[model samples]
Structures are given as C-alpha cells and as structure tokens.
Target: MHVAVLGAGYAGLSTARRLESRLPPEVDLTVVNDGPDHVLVHEVHRAVRRPAVADAITIPLSDVLDRATVVDARVESVDAEAGRADLDAGETLSWEYGALCLGSETAYYGIDGLSERATPLKSLSDAAAIRERFLALCDAGGGQVVVGGAGLSGVQVAGELTALAEERGLAVPDDIEVVLVEQLEEVAPNFPANFRRAVREELTDRGVDVRTGTTVERVTDGGVETDAGPLAYDQLVWTGGITGDDATGGDRPTVRADLRLTDRTFALGDAARAVDADGEPVPASASAAIRMGKTAAENVGRLVDHELNGSADEFDPRLERYRFDVPGWLVSVGDGAVAQIGPTVLRGTAARASKTTVGAGYLTSVGAVHNAVNLAEEELL
Candidate 1:
C-alpha cells in the first residue's frame, strides 16, 4: 500500500517521520516537498538581523527521513477527489492514501499595493530580503520604517529592528522613524494584558513608535498610507497575518477536523485549517502543526493496515482533541526580554534567559538536539 504526504513543513515532516518510524515494513511511504531542506520558520524573524542563524535553522530533508521516498517537486494542483497531485513539471502523482500539509499563505488583507510594496516575513527568502532592507536603512544612517502588524512576528521584528539600530549607535534623524502599526487598540492582542503592557514598555524603552487601532489604507513606493495619516517609510515590513491553503482559491472545503480533506486524504500544518473534534477552530501555531502531523500519521497507519488485512474492526482510534494555550509567551526586545508564564511576569536578563531556554528547548524537541546544544553554548558564552 502507498501512502503519500505532501509539504515538508513542521506538520508534514512530523507526520511523515512518525509514519516512517511506526508503520509496517510493507507500507511504501513517500513525502513530497518543494524544497530540499526544512526551514525552521520561527527563527526567520531573528534571521533578519542575525545572518549566522540562517544556517542553524535549516535541516536537510535527507538527514531526517530514513525509509521514506522524498519527492522534490512543487505541487501545482491537488485533485483530492482523484487522490492525485499535479506537479509543476507537468507530471501527475497518484496515491492510494495521502496527507495534505499545504500550510498557509500570507493574508494581504486587501490593502491596495501592499502585496507588491511590502517585504513580508513569511519564508526564509522574505526574511533575507527584509534583512537586506533593514541593513540598508541602518547603513544609510536613518530612514522612516514601518512594521505592519503587532502579532508575534511583528513584535519580534520591531524588537530586532530596535536592537539593530542600537548596535549601529545610530540616532534617528529628525525626519526618520521606526513605527509599528496594528489595527487593534493594543499590541500583541492575543497575549495577556500584562504581557502586552510589558511588550509596549519594552518597545517604548527601545525607542520604537508603537501605534495601535490603525489600519493600512494603502501602500505605495514611498510608504504605507494608514488611517492615521501618510507615514513615509524607506522600508516596510509586513507581518500582518495568514490564511490556510484555501487562499489560493482552491475549492477544497476548508479542511475538517482530524486534518483530513477526504477519506485517505489529510491536511496538516498551516496548510490545513486545524480544528478540534468538536469542529471548533484551533489557533494556528507551530505547536499545533507538530501535533496535527503526528495525529495524521497515526490515522494514515490505520488506513494502510485496514486495506492490507481487510480488518474493518481495527480502525485507528478517532482523532484526539487538541487544546493548547501558551501558558506563557516570550519576546526578545534588544538585549532584554519580556516573558510571562501563568501570572509570573519577568523582564530584563531573567526574561532573556527564558527566551533563550525556550528556543533551545524547541530545537531539541524537534529532533535538533545537536543544534539545540550549539545554540545553548552560544548563548551561554
């Protein structure tokens, strides 16, 4: 029996790896990915300033998968009904059983010209491009900069920009500014109020202009036109938001619970619209993607087994309910940090240390133990 997995992001890779480890020897597993390496997405923001981080965040696909066949091709079309995917090379891939981990794309929010003018921080290339623009601004001494969105990515980028500016010992010109814009009245809207306050303080302390309850009305070659006014910017970074694979205008119903698109077809990670068994939506996060991957793999195993043995009685258990609330969140603001776990709020070096530990812990949990150690060592020294 053949099991095909598409996409190699956290959700897809995690599912593919789990299936590789547990499935029977008779199962033929194939993982289709557009890229040769799995890019650690969370670190992309930091990579904007720390170029060395780029190498540490990407892992070659070959190093991780032992038995699965890796197909290096971009999926152009997915015929879920026919259990097939059309490749960019005019080839067709068919599968008896498959998983879709298409992941999400950036949500432009319909802002006129923003998609063409702003550098989005979605992929490694996007991060690198932003880094270039940031450094250019830094080298030119000063310029008006705008970071759209106050979500996790926006907060991080704003912080990193602050750090970068300080490192250059550069003072903003009378006309130059670094502003963060958010539609909500408050920044970091998902985090607790206390956490949001801490972040605002951190940004304020670092001299970033934080604006809330504002929307980008339009974007042009010079800058973003906001509801507040025309904000001129030499560099514009978009950390706005993202939507599921359906953003491509595909007709696949926004993925169901259990991460399955149809019988024998599953969608996991950002590509899938993750929802609970009760049909409630789950917040999109890396943690959710990883869990969905494992769950999808287990269910795929059951499909393979039932087909092989004709045992209708032994179907894999129903997909488990996934509920998550980040008890605490951490954000690095230049050399310091703002962290909250439960009601315990921390700032300064303690918070910075916590941020470092969290980063190391995630690396280790994702089977990047060696990289984790290297990171820890770097931070310690």
Candidate 2:
C-alpha cells in the first residue's frame, strides 16, 4: 500500500499534493527528488538577473506537504513493469503504485563541443553561473553574448541579459551585443503568429539581435559555428531543448491520456512525451505539467480505491483522461511581457500583469503565500 512519486518539479509536487487528499490514511506516500526543494523552474530565469528571487521560488518540500515522506535522492532508472526505481544512492525503491515525473535535462543534440562550451539555464546554479560569466564579460569591456535558442526560455534569458547590461550602465548593442539564435524562421516558433510577432517586437525593442533561421552546427571555445556563419561570443547560454531524465533514458517516452507508463506506473511532465485525450501532443510548459500531474493523481487515486476495496471485477477501474486545454500563453521579455488569450494577444501593461499574476498564482496555489506576495512585489510593484 505504498505509492511513490519521483521528482519534485511542478508535475511531481502537484501529483503528490493531490494524492494526499485522495489516498486513505493508512497508505504510505513517498516523494523522491534529488533535492529537498521544489523549484519554480519557469521562474528560474528571473534569478539570472536577480539572484535574491531564487529564495522566493525555491520551496522546501517540508513546507508544502504534510503527510508525504520526502526522500532526497537521484532516480537513476525506473522499471515500470516491476514497480521499482533505482536510485543513485545505491538503494532500490519498491512501491505498489508509482508516478514518474523526473522532469528533463538539457539536450545538446550531439552538437560537437556544445555540451562542454555552453552553459544551460535549467537550474538555480546554472542561472548564477550565467550571471557571473556575463558580468565578467561586461567587466572585460564586453563582447557578444549569444543565446542558442529562441524558445520561451531562450527569449527570456536573452532579454534578461540586455536588461542586465543596461543596469550595469553598458550600452546594449554597442557595449554588450546580445544575440538570440533560432533554427526556425521566427522566435517562439511553435506559438501563435500574433504572439510570436509580439515576442520578436519586444526583443527588438530591448535591443536584442534576433537571428531567426540560424542553426548551431558546432561550438568551439572561441565561438559557435552556425548555418549562417561563425559567430564569436564571450559567453554562450543554451536553452535550445530538453530530453527525458536520465532515469527514463533517451528522449521523452510517449504516454497516453491516462499518463500511464505501465499498469501501476504513471508518467507526466517533461519526463514523458504526453498526449491529450484527442491524441494531441502536449507542450512542455509548467501549466501543462501541473494539469497532467493532477489528472494522473486522479487516475492513481481511483486505482488505489479499486484495489483496496477488494472488488472482484476483472476489468480495471475507469481512469480520468488528461486534456491540454490551456487558456493562454505568457512570456516575460526583460522588463516587458506578452500574453495571448484565445484570439487576442496582449502586450505592455496588460501582458506584464498577466505574467505577474500567473507566477504569483502558482506560488499561492502551492501554499507559498509569503513567496507569492514577494514575487508580486518584485515583478509588478
């Protein structure tokens, strides 16, 4: 009667929180994460500019959960069929039911020297490293700062670099050239056209040299080799893409609407390539991950009930299905933001407000009331 939830990102934490209310008091619940805290990954980019912001976004698991026992260990691999997960600490975790929400790692796409040369923006340490390196470059009289990705993370970090340059009294393009490279024809390539346009406009307005359709072929100590040409940079940050966790191995494995990897194991968030009820692929975003986690929690709860009740039914219990129906998209560009709701796209104050609200709302939902207030004050006021 033990249930295990792996990883402490948005998906894993959300699932664990929901399971606490759904499961019986006798059932044992455990959460395995590499760290003691659940990081608000979507807001980690803000830490690149303001290191103090990390305090508000990193919530200790103890503060958020009451009944679940938190196990701070790295998940090495999961054998869903056997209901077992191997940990880096040389211990095995066995459970009756499990959820795999191990999140993702940066994907270098096998680009030569890229992994060695480029710093990724996936963790708090990564953000701190990026800030330190960028500041050093600025102190050395500035050079080109290239971000090899134009996705939301890429765009946000690039914007932050520009904003940081201004704060240091450096002339943006003249003193510190911030370049955003993307293989696609535009930034935010997968987003709606209007949202894409708004993001590009914001980047441009902030003095970012947006280079669309520019693919990175290789990375050297001096600079990057691209389809366009070689571009020298003092510092490089990669937000290009993500792959499945090492525990899951390879690219993200596909999971259906039920979010099940096996009869008793569920996978959600960046840990799996998840699809909605209609078979539409779900994008890797915090909003989508939270929804998928809750959906999987419901299914897991139903399975727990069915098994504990000793029903003689031959068939499995009906499970809840997940649907990717997010209402809108929001992204922050330096001090500016953009939001797209249905057919309408918003910018300036409206979009900034939406961005602030979403971040603060997520914090509040996770019972981080003081953190939520701090975030609102830092971003809006």
lDDT of 1: 0.79
Writing each residue's lDDT as its tens digit, candidate 2 over 1-381 gives 999999989999999999999899989999999999999999989999989889989999999998999999998888988999999899999988889998889999999999999999999999999999999988888899999999889999999999999999899899999999999999999888999999999999999999999999999998899999999988999999999888877558899999998988999998898989998999898889999989989988988888889962667988889999999999999999999999899989999999999999999999988899888888877
Per-residue lDDT over 173-217 for candidate 1, one digit per residue giving the tens place of the 0 to 100 score? 343477999999988887779999999998888788999999999
The C-alpha lDDT values of all candidates are 0.79, 0.92
On TM-score, the leading prediction is 2
Score every model by TM-score. Answer: 0.90, 0.98
lDDT of 2: 0.92
Candidate 1 regions off by >4 Å? 172-176, 245-253, 277-280, 312-317, 325-327, 377-380
